[model samples]
Target: MRYTITGGAGFIGSHLAKALVSKGHSVDVIDNLSTGSMSNLDDIKNKISFHKTDILDADSLEGIIQNTDGIFHHAALTSVPESFTRQQEYENVNVNGTENIFKIAKKLHVKVVFASSSSVYGDTKTIPTKESHKLDPINPYGITKLNAEQLATKYLQFFDVVGLRYYNVYGDTMPGAGVISKFYYCIQNNMPLEIDGDGKQLRDFVYIDDVVNATISSMEKNTGSCFINVGSGVATSILELANLFLKYSGSASKIIFKQQDKGNVMTSQADILFAKQLLGWKPQTTLEDWIKNLYKS
Candidate 1:
């Protein structure tokens, strides 16, 4: 099978690309290298066709994405704090770029498994939010992701689309280097680990391997058109995560508290029964296990 992955040079996309290549599938990577690094694809560079093009370029995207079995759409501006100042840019890249992919996929009659975010739930009243939870994003980035999901719903009549509402997806090479990576960086550099707000906020940090597996399953399995939450379904507090990092790394680095960014949610936990029911996928990595292993060396 042949596949196309937008933003394939980034963290999650790069991992997916490598996985596909390992399975002896032909892969094509499309990335502008704006936030993604070429080094991420260095090992598999020659194995796949790499296109240095943005998703907004329909002509280029359509040309490369044609004849593909499926598309894993991961291209977007994904910074929450940054989205506030650059709302229009977020809308352009996340919403408009997504629509472009849907339009092209519609033309080609291909399936798209795109990245959505857990932020769409905002600070919901429900704990362990379900797919049926109300979507009321408090930030521009979440708003754009919600818009993209809506687009996916609208395009379902034409082709198959699965939008995975990813929670805090973290790994060794996560793009934008999420909280776990940031903590590791501080530990390595002997710097203080900074926590916004009271460090009591809870989050569901899903490992990249599990996320990649779930993503691939979504495309391979006939899940139809739906949005599912991809996460560990376990909620860990920020302070607990910090302590775990300190314990594993043996770092004496102090954890500092700072003001929380605007639109930051207090807690996020995924009710992933839908994912298991639809794709037969469930997260295998725990935050504690990954952190302990990372510093075990």
Candidate 2:
């Protein structure tokens, strides 16, 4: 099977592409290099077809949609504060870009699995937000993701679609791709790990490997219009996560607390019961284990 992963050179997308390739599937990537790096795909540079195109460009995207079997749509502007600063850019990339993919998928009879975010649930009133939970995104980035989910649903009336509400995905793909990686890097270098507010903010941090596995399961097994939360169903506070990283890295650098981010979500987690039932997938990494392996090499 031939698979096209938009943002394929990104942290999660790059890892997913390699996984698909390892499974004997032909993989192609479309990336704008906005935040995705060519270096992330250094090992498989010669093994796969790569297109330097943006999903926002419909004509460019349409040219490549005809040849792929399924599409993993992962391209978007993903920064929370950045989205707040540049609302229109987020609207263009997350909302309009998604529409373009769905439009081309509908036209080409292609199956699509979108990389949605847990941020769409905002600071959920529930500890572990289920797919049935209310979506009250507080930040513009989350709002755009929620809008993309809606657009996907609207398009599903005409196309086969699955959306995975990925939790805080972190792993070995890129050094600075996620907050965990960044914090670890800082700790290793004896630099202060910046903590926003009191470090009480919580998240359902999932490993990239698990996220990719669940994403593939969603693509292969899920039918009709489906949305599932892909997470560990575990919540860890920011301070606890930092401590774990420090323990793993064995760094002596002290954490520095800073002023709280105004628009940041205080807490967010995922309820993956539906995913377990439908995709038969659960997170395979624990915080302690992942952190230990993170600093091994």
Candidate 3:
């Protein structure tokens, strides 16, 4: 199969691209290098098609969709605070870029698997957010992702579409240096770990491999018009995560508590039972185990 992965050089996208190549499938990648990096594809530079283009450009979508079998739309402005600063940019990339993908997919009849985010749940009181739970995003990033999910669902009637509501995915993926990467960097430098508020706010940190597997399952199943949460279904507080990192890295860094940001959600965890039932996907890496592996000396 020939696959087109938007943001292919990005953290999750790069991993997914490599997985497809290992499975004997041809891959064409489109990335603008905004938050993505080509270095992530250094190992397979010559094995896949690479394009430095943004999805917002009119020709970007049409050019890639013409000859692709499936699309993994991983392109987006993902920073929560960044979205607040650049609302229009976020809208263009996340919302408009998504529309472009769907439009092109409709024209070419290609299957799509979109990367949604847990931020769509916002500050809702729900302990473990489910797909059926009410969505109330407090930030522009989450709003854009929710809109993208809706558009994907609308596009599903015309073509195969699956929206993955990814939880707090973290790992040492080169292009996707998320919060986990920040933690690692801080620990490695012996910098004080900054804890927002009491540091008791919970988050579901799903490993990159688990997310990749769930995405592949969604693609292979051709799951249409469904929003699935890809996560470990366990919540670990920020302070707890820092301690785990410290233990894993054998670092002697002290922790500092900071006031929580006004709009930040206090807690977030996912209900991944649906993913397990639908795609036979459940996160295999435990929190402590993942931290240890990442920080193994």
Q: Which candidate is the best by lDDT?
A: 1
**Residue-by-residue lDDT tens digits, candidate 2, 26-86:** 9989999989999989888888899999998899899877888899999988888778899
Give the whole-model CA lDDT for all candidates, comma-separated.
Answer: 0.92, 0.87, 0.86
TM-score of 3: 0.96
Clashes of each: 0, 0, 0
Error of 1 at 293 (Å): 0.8
Q: Which stretches of candidate 3 lie over 4 Å from their true place?
A: 174-177
Leading candidate by TM-score: 1
Sort every candidate by lDDT, greatest first.
1, 2, 3
TM-score of 1: 0.98
Instruction: List clashing residue pairs in candidate 3.
Output: none
Q: What is candidate 1's local distance difference test score?
A: 0.92
Model 3: ten consecutive residues of lowest lDDT: 171-180
Residue-level lDDT tens digits of model 3 in 1-297: 999999898889999998898899999999999878888888888999998888999685686568888889998888887788899989999999999989988988878898999999998688788999998999899999999887877777799888899988876664323556777778877798878799888899888888999998999984566989988999999889988888878888899988777657888999998999999888888879977776555
Error of 1 at 94 (Å): 0.6
